[model samples]
Target: MIIRLNDMVFYGYHGVNDEERKLGQRFIVNLEMQTHPETDSVIKRLEDTVDYTKVYAEIREIMESRQFLLLENCANIVADKLLTDFPLIWKLKLCIQKPSVPIQGILKSVEVEVQRTRE
Candidate 1:
């Protein structure tokens, strides 16, 4: 089965630049997770699957409650936490978007994608 959590937004300071870190910015995250179902469940249910709400809450807590030096580290932490907490999930693809980025040229948001798999 496949589960998705899309466009969850957060306001936090996560960037390489000092200004970007001090000023803070808006970030958007999209997470897609793949899992295997149980063989003998009487009824299929979301509760038995990965909970997107819990994932979102975790991400929000991580982003808002702490300071990170880089988006890469933040993404890694999120992926690791999700994989560790959700045993049913086999694979996860996480995308983090930094909108209103601190750049010189006319461009859109910059994003980072990370894929993690559990044994």
Candidate 2:
């Protein structure tokens, strides 16, 4: 089974440029998690599965905690946290995006993706 959330916006200071880290920017997070199905063979309930709200809250907490110099690092942080916190999850793909980046007006945003699997 898989649980996924796409394009969730977050306010964070994660970038390489000084202006980016200082001024901050809007970040879009896309998380995809692969996990085992809930229940043994009879009970079927959403509550039996991994609650995405908890995962979202964890990600939000990270975005609000400190500043990161790179989206790749932040993405890795999220991926690791998910795998660590949710033992049922076997793999995860996390993508972080910076929208309306302070570029030379050539592009709209920049994004970084990281994938992690349990050992």
Candidate 3:
């Protein structure tokens, strides 16, 4: 089954510039994962599925815990953590968006996406 979490926002200190790291900014996270349950039948228990509340908490913790120099690193970190935390997940796709990036031109946001699979 596929589970998706979209537009989870958090304030984080992540950037290449010193000012950006110090001032921090808003970030948006989107996650999609494919999990295999032990049984193909309908999920009757929480243990039969990935608990997304735990997933959100873990993502939030990762975002708030440290400073990343790039969104690519941030996305990768999240993907790695999720894969480790939930072994049932066979594949994951994640995106991190920075809405208040420092740029001379007007733009909506800057985003980075990473996809991973368990081997």
Among these predictions, the greatest lDDT belongs to 3
lDDT of 3: 0.90
TM-score of 1: 0.89
Prediction-by-prediction clash tally: 0, 0, 0
**C-alpha RMSD (angstroms) for model 3:** 1.5
Select the stronger candidate by TM-score from 1 and 3: 3
**lDDT, residue 23, candidate 2:** 83
Per-residue alpha-carbon lDDT of candidate 3 for residues 9-43, written as tens digits (9 for 90 to 100): 99999999999899998899999998765443666
Which number leads on TM-score?
3
TM-score for all models, in order of appearance? 0.89, 0.87, 0.93
Q: What is residue 3's positional error in candidate 1, in angstroms?
A: 0.8
For candidate 1, write residues 1-119 as lDDT tens digits: 67798999999988888887888888999999988655324326776777777888998998887778788899999999988888877889999998887779988888889999887
Which portions of model 2 show Cα errors greater than 4 Å? 37-43
Kindly indicate the candidate among 2 and 3 with the higher lDDT.
Answer: 3
Residue range 10-95, candidate 2, lDDT tens digits = 99887888987888878899999877544334326766566788999999999877799878788888888888887767778888
Ten residues in a row with the worst lDDT in model 2? 35-44
lDDT of 3 at 48: 78
**Can you tell me which runs of candidate 3 are displaced by over 4 Å?**
37-42
With candidate 2 superimposed using the best TM-score fit, by how many Å does residue 59's alpha carbon deviate from the native?
A: 0.5
